[model samples]
Target: MRQATLDAMDEVKRSLDGIEAARARLASRPSSLGGRGLDGVFTRYLDHGSKQLTWLRGTLGSATALAGVASEVGDSGMELGILQMTGPRLQAAMFGTLLLATWVDFLQLADALLRDCPTCGSEKLFADLHRVQSRMTPTLADLASGDSERIEAAATAMPVLMGELTHEFDTIRREARSAMEVGGKVMVAAQVMELLALISTLNMSLPRPPPAASTTLGMGLVMSSGGVIAGSRLVVSAEWVEMMRRLVQAGVISLPAVSAAVRIHGGQVMMAQANQDLPEGVREALGDSPEVRGMKVTGKAGAGMAEAPRHHVMPKEHREWFERRGFKGDMDIDQFCVRLEQSHHEAIHGGANWKLGRTWPREWNQMIMQLLGKSGRETGRALTRNEILNIVAENMKLYDIPMKFTKGRRR
Candidate 1:
């Protein structure tokens, strides 16, 4: 009868081993490419454990009642030796029932550990498992309340049950740690990929480039398009404005990151267009030149602010043009401004004019005069202030540029 009871306990342990393996698979399957929607497996397995435990508990209760009845019949001289014969078996059944409850608690803990993760609510689950472990590994003194024979039976069962529980506890801890370790990195990578995907969508739909114009002619065209032409071209290129609205509605990427990305990309696009229109000679000269010139201008004073010598730039109106599109997130305001100045110079004249001091060059003034004459209705003279202003306004309107006009002669 002892051997038979031991065999039954071994069978129960084997069943538990299978259940543990299934639970581990259930937790990991969602991470696999082919198993994305297989999470239903966990729910189904939990339900199965619940049903089995209910049946097992009822069976154990019935066996206990039968044991009591058999003991009474023996006292009445029925000559039925069931109590004496089934002593070890009855002990085994009671101990096994307790182990089964522990197993169910463990299953519940595992389910909780796997479900709320990356969100990381495993503390409660771990607490419950610790309580079960304490119960399973109780001291021998606790069983001393029964007769010496019952104490011996508990001693025999306790070690086996504790060994099984210990093994399961180790398995859960290791599996949970591994799952969480990989889960965090996977979540971040997935989000970054999504943002990149949206950026690609924007790039794919960019409008075809406008017809190629001469360095001088393109400058006039850009200026004439309106202060906004450069920016407007960017607007239609990607349909990013609409994309941003949708992204904001969806609430995927952080608003700050999105804003920074849009600004950086727009600035880069404008720089590319400016580079394209540059004269080959100027572009070549800049590639070979290493000298950097500093330009300075005074800041307008406010109540508590002192006037400072700010770095000046050529085609002064363009400083504002770059600012409207925004700056790179990684760089400081000064560095961003420096890059803008460099790009603006390369766009207009094909290279940095380090040889020229802070003052606006005569050549730049001549070019502006020429642009005014070309765009104006009249011929033969550098355009007057009113004529230049009117022409710039008309060009900005026609070409959709986003820059504002400055009447200052130095710009």
Candidate 2:
């Protein structure tokens, strides 16, 4: 098994070599936006790729060191406890390394496609890559309207590749979190059992009503021995070692050609699609099937649709409530909504609003987006007062609160 770990170290090194080769290939492309030009996207992708490669190399070194140490420890429980504690951190590092490698690979392919395309020539970027990448529809539309079949194919394939990557990262994140939780619980339980065993031993062997000095010394010894036993148990269990071994093996297999195994679910594909305002041509390229049409851009679902460009607090009841309470400012509306919910809860069951005013509003906004089934990039407009009130009304209505807000404020 140790030999296999040593072999994994070699495999990681080879992967690094492949990454370096890909980086070199990316660098060779003309980056200027002019004739036969290379754009800023290429430069940005290369720079990000370089940083990720550096991180991967550093993490690989750490993994190699850990493997070597484990080999020498050879079944020592105390050493095993140290390794067990270190296991999750090592797994996380490997995960990061592999994930970054995969991202770099995607960037490499994207760079190649853009550089090779005639219609979407490598134009110098005036803005950030994220700004361009986030708004992919315009680029796709350009490709679709032109005679550049190669570029069109690349543009269409990009979203599919992106969907696969999202699924892989999401899956790994969830599985790694679950593994860490289970490993932690196992360690804790082992320690607790060891403590119980020590207490039982003391109870059986110690004199009934022993001397105080002897009792104190014996108690100290019991605690010290219990700690040793607890530490040893983690390494001694075949289950734990096997888990770590499997995690290491998985890391070895995750980087190269993982997209083949990753199933791109509808949510990821829809998110990639909805984040952009796709042109009809590009939509046709993406099959323009019923599944595609079923998806909507942000804030355009069923009865939730708003024709007006803006929405605001039009209801006299809400305006009066706000004025009577003397709550002014944009944040004040958020506070009112939160407090209203808390008041009703307190009225019924009596509990304070733990997440009151100014408590991680950014996080609260993110949570709001998640609940609304929208991503940050897709949310192009800030909700007006009436819009906020409408959302609050949905929750409030669940608790039987009157939703008296007008749909749109009159200009």
Candidate 3:
């Protein structure tokens, strides 16, 4: 591995250690006067923090594995592929480290509030806080394996989880007012709102699988299985693709052999399809022709059917602003669209009240426009493709939008 990658890994590890120490110190704080109810809250907070640290450690392990593979690969092209694969894992580890540190600070704030005003730490409040902590625990314990599917699932669950936390905190704040003096109540409510902001940040920062990778994997499964298996059944995630490339580079597998096996498997699937009987719903869903099924699996509309609505990640309304900022050429703003399920599309654009400016899509577009305008004003030139992507990624992180950008002519 390159020294820079090694250095990054070391820094991440050190940061993790620092966070652990901070959490330990918080955990070791003297018990609150409010008895076991308050103590239980503190313990649960520490336990949840520990779980997050474990997940971060697992992410670092994955980055290390990719780095080892990158070091062994002689081809520059392969090296670049490894770098791309490893970059996000490291970024996620670092991001998680920062998030955990902030979480600890929030916990400390809560601890202090309870210590000064034990009456504020009502049994009901403690119960609500505990519920939020339980909800925040990692869904998968074996995240150290760096399983992309599990990680994506966990990330997908964040928005709902954080939203719940926000609601609970609001309730906690409202209830706290009745149990404390006016000054103490104001402090508690302010702290709770700050925590709510942190929850929003957490929702946006969690890593999600890119749409292109999922689409490619879905299509690959359909083609490989000769339409016998549903495309949605076996997605070849980006992590799996990277693992395969690493195996090939290490000489444990050959491309020709893999190709041959896929072809053979496809033939077998075709034979099975001929003799097997499918359920009525399955048969209806698959239709009578393999070709038509393949088209539908890949999100393509047949002659008489319409595809799902296409939502432009880079809003079409502000096309000219993006065009002026180097969003044309290979990275055309027009090509950045994703076909979303109808309800999802509606939700993004503000559902039935889309005309209002408060919806996610509207807010996201406004943020992007401001970014572009700022860049243009500062540099007096177009932003590079990578620069534009960085801006988009940051905005997505800020707004809790899933990071799904597709670049190509719409299907």
Candidate 4:
């Protein structure tokens, strides 16, 4: 996980470099419209991308820290068995698992942001803008001539083109900002989790009744040694002991509640990981068998026929949409698909006997398209891979589609 976080950080830094280069190229372009043309829009676009990349880098750094801490805790033997133990150690283990879960969430979100928003770090947008500007150069040059008719025509045409470009820029910026906003919220939530963990650890580490009893013993000695002065000190010591006792009592009472909540949350996180349609890190971590090579293509596993037909989680019909959102290569989309039993696959797509209008308004594929369309309309961008898989998982559950591979696996 730490390595993954570091890799994401490196990717974000590379994107920052690309944004910087794009900005430099935009800067080199002569501004014939005096900062009100494509130059201005492209500059803002690159600047926004740069800012998002910097923010992502910082978030990944925090994730790296959490990942490191979780790793250390895991190495110290805080596995599932730790939950059965008592005392501060169990509290510590619970917190560690919570942090680990939080780190996993951050990693998934960061990976999704990188995949879904290529413009967040790439120079492709700037390159496209430059190409558009190059195409308009001849017309722009005509504006320099003293012909009133040509100047008027150019003036009339340029703003329309500029307006269209500005609209496109605004749309992309909004989408990028939306994606970054989600990341920011996740980071804030992780910080809150850390704060809670710290409080829980401190509560558990309090000296308990021993320190307060010791203070009382000291008060007795002081009172016996001196008269009025000793009495005054004794009163102060009593108050201190009382406060300590109250704090310890509060810790004793509250610790169990906090532990229970964290345990419940941890369970939810594990469940979510299990429900993912794609077998990525989650499957490996849970000790599932390795994916069969060429299983997706031949639909066969070794010498035996595969257990089920392969289902494309993202739907192969909309391959172009996924391709546009960074699943570009030929086999890239295939990686997202999973194999399911023939019955499960049919059920997901609406079983053979199921009719369109009489049964339901949409099948699983149509439902996915609706989800994608709704998300795109809301965010002004395509859904990220994580987001798409999440929708797939949720719909599978809604339809009671049993996962063939994960049916008997321990979550």
Q: Rate the local accuracy (lDDT) of all candidates.
A: 0.35, 0.36, 0.49, 0.37
lDDT of 1 by residue, 1-411 (tens): 222333333444554455545545544544333322224534543454444445444443443443344343312211122222223333333344445444554554455354434433445455545565455544223332222234333533343344445445545544555566577645544443334334332232123233352122222112122221233433122233333333322221112222222322332212222112332222221221221011011111321123322222224544443243331121112221111234343333432464443343433433544565465536654434334334433433333322311112222
lDDT of 3 by residue, 1-411 (tens): 244565667877997898788778777777655543225535766787888887798778866876675565554434443444554465456445644654664565466556655556445545655665565445433223343333433332333343344444445544555555555666765665455445432223222224444333212333232233333343223333334334334322222222222222222111112112322222222233443222211112322225566566777777776777655643456445555676666555564555654454455566577786798679887776556656665655554444433332433
Clashing pairs in 3: none
TM-score of 4: 0.25
Tens-digit per-residue lDDT, 289-337, candidate 4: 3331111111125314356566655667777887776554322455344
Q: After superposition, how far is residue 389 of candidate 4 from its true place, in Å?
A: 3.9
lDDT of 2 at 354: 33
Model 3 TM-score, 2 decimals: 0.39
lDDT of 2 at 196: 33
Give me the overall lDDT of model 1: 0.35
Model 4 regions lying over 4 Å from their true place: 1-307, 351-360, 397-411
Total backbone clashes of candidate 2, pairs 3 or more residues apart or in separate chains:
3
Candidate 1: Cα lDDT at 309: 26
Give candidate 2 regions above 4 Å deviation. Answer: 31-41, 82-86, 121-411
- Candidate 1 shows a clash count of 16
Whose TM-score is greatest here? Answer: 3
Error of 3 at 401 (Å): 33
